[model samples]
Target: MSLNDASCTFESMTSPTTLKTSTEPPLVSAVHWTRAQWLLLMVVCTVLALDGLDVSMVGVALPSIGQELNLGTDSLQWIVSAYVLGYGSLLLLGGRLADLLGRRRIFLIALSVFAAASLLGGLVDDPAILIATRFIKGLAAAFTAPTGFSIITTNFAEGRERNKALSIFTTFGASGFSLGLVVGGLMTSLSWRWTFLVSVPIAVVVVFLGMKFIPKDKPSAENSGHDIWGAVTLALGMLGLVYTLVSAPEQGWGSVATIAGFAVSIAVLAAFAVIENKVKHPLIRFSILKEGWVARANLSAVGLFGSYLSFQFIVTMYLQSVLGWTPLGMALALLPAGLLVATSAPFADRLIEKFGATQLILTGLTALGLGYVLFLRVGTTPNYVLDILPSVVLLGIGFALAFPSINVQATAGIKDSEQGLAAGLIQTSTQVGAALVLAVTTALVSGHGQAAGTVSAQAMLEQYRPGLILSAAVAIAALLVAAAPSRRRVRT
Candidate 1:
């Protein structure tokens, strides 16, 4: 059934007695939202989907771009890493800007930048210029993503309505990535540039619709002072940290460069913390992390995205390098996880409501860990149905359940004024945490390959297994974190 149909069914099933009886207008589930409300949600979701779409599509086209540009592996790697570095660094600032400025204003401006960057990225010939454009796009996305998230949280009421809205929003984001793989494969066959160009028009339409439908509000007068020092330190600190993590594998984890990078990053961040404490108006209120659920939810997001990225890296390597599968075939093989996440939009919020976000998270992590464990049994020639499909299905189910719920819990009790701050924190955790895990996983795979030089296909398969094991271990650790008792903490 269509989304509207499912929503209609849900609306019909609700009892009138259960509805709010006060004079304040009744809170409506997303299924019963008016056209304008739905349109507003779509506008924000489209921006997020564009972010996901751009990332995945560019990933698929990397080989073609390398071939055409005559770039080495190191140079080509920067094409992706530049984007991540920009994105992971400024997410905190982006979210705070949304709250300080109007969400509508910040969102529209950033999206415009994103569109402009996409256009430049597609047209550019110089590899350095192309990488710069990717970084610009990532910087734009860092703003749009959290602002879009806060837009929903502020516009929708806090219970079922917001839950459903977030589920649908995240589904669109996940689906965009899933579908982009297929789209990228097709576009790359014609030209690698198409992947970059494709997002431009969609982003333009979104910007236009946002202007018309998204309501505007003025910034707070009570908090007019700018925290220039805080912003600088935080941004610099995050940039240094993410850059260090992204480069550590290639630089050697114990190298002087990596050590100095970490030291500088940590010291800068410590300065940021002191500034936040002393400033009349801080960039981020450090107290938000004191809320145990909020902290746990952020950690969960880190684990969720971290493991998934690492797993995807390993799977992509295995499918293409070992099995000699086409890009399109690999895309199809992984399509089920994306499909499951997309289809779960209808019931994900309902599941959150019934089981509670905490329960669903624990269960989802269990499934995710098991999926990684199952993949450990992979051989040189394995049955897709027996060895892969089951793990794929479990991973799909795990993500479909956990991702939305983690989002819900993160922002649940947060006041609307700081909603953008809360949103940025969780998203920042996801990106930065994923970078760290993927770097370590890459190091493991690379180290193993060097140890067993000129290995057979079977031995090559063995090289990637350690990364797979790391992914599973991360999931299990996260599961333990979620399952821990938090009665006092939740109350606090």
Candidate 2:
């Protein structure tokens, strides 16, 4: 059964509720959406953009940070891995809280926390403290990202209105991260601290705007208990799993500590599964993963983000440390990927509607795979135009197509009450996937003596090349998963 077989429409993959007629009168097309709607959309988009900005900005600043702190690659990776650990681990709980307590409240509080963390991170001279602040920021984002996503889903109608809003929202996020590279470069030139400080003011402004513009809504009555044990086990399990992965290469992959860490992590997660089965109001309803599209979307997210972040990390290192490019020059080199995503925002929804999300995902994955493959040819003194620009442009196009579609598919059939659940699942996949893949990539590169901070450019390239190959392998794996056929079908 070909995925392109005329019978397998986009709708076939979504939940049954997607087919129902709206009780409310139809609003105008998304382009003409009202001021209030637009404001709400902006609120969520800005929050997501802030998340993107913080992550990417820090990425470009990593080298400066390393030099300033006298930190090695292993230590530098913790700046990123800590954030992913905090964000990925608590996301399920964050989503459940948003659904149970109130999206507006959760979103505001988390945004506030994020602002404070950003400020603290900028002021901190201690590497551990700086990394701790990054963790706090990630924890804050775990709540804000999903709540914002759910807010958009609940406000906009499912089919077209929601689609357009999501495309713009996701694009802003991609743009924020994309553009953050350049912004990060500029800030890093001034002082690496500025990258952390820059987002504080923007976040504060967004919080004030959110308090005013975001409509208040009651919590879902369906959820009765907080499922305390479930939250604890899930958090611990995720933390342990991520920790083990992050530490494995350092500890020696086959060492007792690494083996024990994996064992403990698996044990805790198993307990979490048991608790979820028994608890009346589980933090996560495992049944959600049983939804074919939902599961596929999450796996696809893991592959997409895992590969891209790992690729970006390797490139940032190669360009700055090895090639000796200025921060601004490196940012400009990678700007095309972000630019393509920003430019294509308007057309994304239409593309999904016309070609169907399934096809677009397949197309996106193919482009992504090809982009990674192209980058594998990169040498110590490779031509920017011939060796890099083509890959960057292709990656941008891949993201422009895939990110929004994945979001749409993941939440399509979910009830409004469970929208946060759907958002959490996908975002968890993204962060955790990135954390896991990046840990492996870092280990691979670092193990090759790239950690000495004195290796020659040619030697550095040899170490980093394996990370690039891993990125390509990840994309191809995701492409295969996306191409796999679903057992059930409906139409878009």
Candidate 3:
């Protein structure tokens, strides 16, 4: 039956048999998977894949990018930090705009912009332009990521069908991230620019499919009203805070710029909170904060993702610099971790349903902590089979288990209207955590490098050992938080 007919039928059914009647229709009948929907989802996943590739690929290409551009250790960070800042800061606003405008429209626009930005990044000769392009690329990602979720959630009916679709969507996201590492390695072997240019064709195809398949849905009344002041304040606040975090490792904590950034961040975020409370249409609904599960889930994501990103960065440096491995070799060594992350996710989903989100998250955190502790053994003596492989496998399993569980819990008790906002918030916490931890770890490594003359690869590896241990400690803390009475008491 057509979607219009299905809607009419749904409206007409008011009796106890409504549930029965609803089931009588084909599962796909509820919402037609038009060419538009298929194209949109494909492109969304593809764009996300590109985002993942850019992130992982840059790290693989960093040495080359740095060598060519003559970047110092501290300035090199801008390539990563700039993209994250733009992506994280604009996510919430992007979601709101998708809800207010249209998901299909936004998805297309985002793809086009992302493609252009990728082109710019690839072609740029100057380091400043490269950083600027990365920032712009991130802006495009912010728009696309949240809209992808919103579209799937809105288009698919809830329960098993929605669950399956979301799982598939998330799988693509995870796989894309992992696959990017492999692709980045291969591309960087040819040239660092290929890493960025690779996305152009994918983006172009995604845009074409998005235009064809995704349906055009009118904006809901709640989403139509945009809070300009609230958005501005929130963006400014997040930018200030993230900038402070990214810069702190390079500039001392006592530096004037660092101090001012943090101070302004606190003030602006405080102002944002006040504005949110008073605004007629707030960017984030204050009422959602009262939900215990939502709060815990977001906090858990921050801690969990912080550890994950730091480990990825540290390991990359260790493999290439310390072990005397090429980018391709490092990428190949890390392939098992990515595969494990992908392989474990489906099992993690089933575990979530059976044991609930809290249990799964706690288990995942425990695994992640143990993985880090195991990684402390990684030294100048390269033993992939005995030491590093086991750690990578455990790390992969931990992340695969934790991410989906937290995502489920965060979105679980929210109304449809609030889903986009909640998803945006979760993603924001993830990027912010990554940025913060990376900065902290980089600072520690840099300080150690300076103290030791002619910083050897082994010395750099030793420097990060302390940081990794600390990250493991943080994971243990997260496990405790997840297992706490308050978290356990809250029901989905």
Candidate 4:
């Protein structure tokens, strides 16, 4: 089906609570539409931004969180693990629920949940409670993020207009991560709790604006009950996988706990595959994996976001410990990179128009790899402009180039019926991949039997240097994935 044809269906809509239908004109037809539509667009964009911001912002706050809670290194790791585990595991389930129920309904409810979760996190005294709240917040985010993207894909026109909106949405999300670092640093200075509390007001505003401006969701008749067992298995399997990876660095990879996690995850995921094959309305349709561009983009998603974040993790340590930059200074130094992403993104849409997804992804990966390679040259001496700024710029450009193109390609051919699930899969790949890669990165940086954060600056840098090369290698691997397209045309 063509984009215009997809637009034709949205002309008829239902009330938010009802399964009824209507005959309004296709919202997609109005590229230069009303102010209300623009408001809706912006609100959803902010919602997506909040999701991305939560990930990177909380990362910067980890040290502060550890200090305030008197948490151990393993506990600090759980701060990240809890959120990634929740987000990655429930993504497909969340996305499927949106499709089966209503996007607008799920979106609003999730926002409220996020606000509540943030409040819980702020008020919590125990590290376990804080981690639980973070997990719940991330669970809420898993629902909101992909649903927001699916909303954009359905509401916006296809071609240039849709692509433009996507880029703008992604730019906000990208900016949110970088901005979160800055905001997190400042907030953590005041109190680490603020990192959690701050999101509440933003969520409140998004919910209000969203309810006012958001369009009603019309359900598909075919979108009935979703796969129950798949959700169960996927959740367990993903949590197991994330836990295994997170624990492997501290405990030996061959340790009983680590081995158990891996065994459980692999077995459960294999069972999930069988259940998916047997079930009707499976959370993920097996055939979707056969889609060439979808497969390619998802493969790179693993590499792109995973390696990018792991690189940031390394840079954060180097800046704070080795160079002795303050948290605020670390954030400020990365600010230019954030701005570069915003500046480059508007043009990235046009680049996709010219070079297409395949070429853009490969080029972006190449640049991203080079940026990592540049980081390998960083000395103990701190020269932000000379050493870090150039690499940051390249990474910013690389992400801008890579993100939208891959999104457009992966989602372009998918039907509206399954777009939510498809979006979920993309995000799932990203966070899950990041979680796995982060474990490896930390393991490499920490070295064998070395306690996290118990090393001298010189020793830490020595271990970290090899990890940077690993990040570069991951980027190169993504480039290779994009380079070798299957013989079949991308599903559309």
The C-alpha TM-scores of every prediction are 0.93, 0.93, 0.89, 0.90
Where is model 3 more than 4 Å wrong at Cα?
1-40, 344-348, 450-458, 487-492
The lDDT per prediction is 0.85, 0.86, 0.74, 0.78
If candidate 4 were superposed on the true structure by all CA atoms, what would the RMSD be? 7.1
Give the better candidate number (2 or 3) by lDDT. Answer: 2
- Taking the tens digit of each residue's C-alpha lDDT, what string does model 3 give over 375-444? 8988887689998888888877787777777776666545666667777877787888778877787777
What is the TM-score (0 to 1) of candidate 4?
Answer: 0.90
lDDT of 1 by residue, 371-411 (tens): 99999998888798899999999999999888888888888
> Who is ahead in lDDT, 1 or 4?
1
By TM-score, highest first, what's the ranking? Answer: 2, 1, 4, 3
Task: Find the 10 residues in a row with the least total lDDT in model 3.
Answer: 8-17
Alpha-carbon RMSD to native, per candidate: 5.6, 3.6, 7.1, 7.1
lDDT tens per residue, model 2, 330-410: 899999999998888888877776566777888898899999999988888889999999999999999889888888777
**Stretches of candidate 2 above 4 Å error?**
1-31, 449-454, 489-492
Ranked by lDDT, the better of candidates 2 and 4 is 2
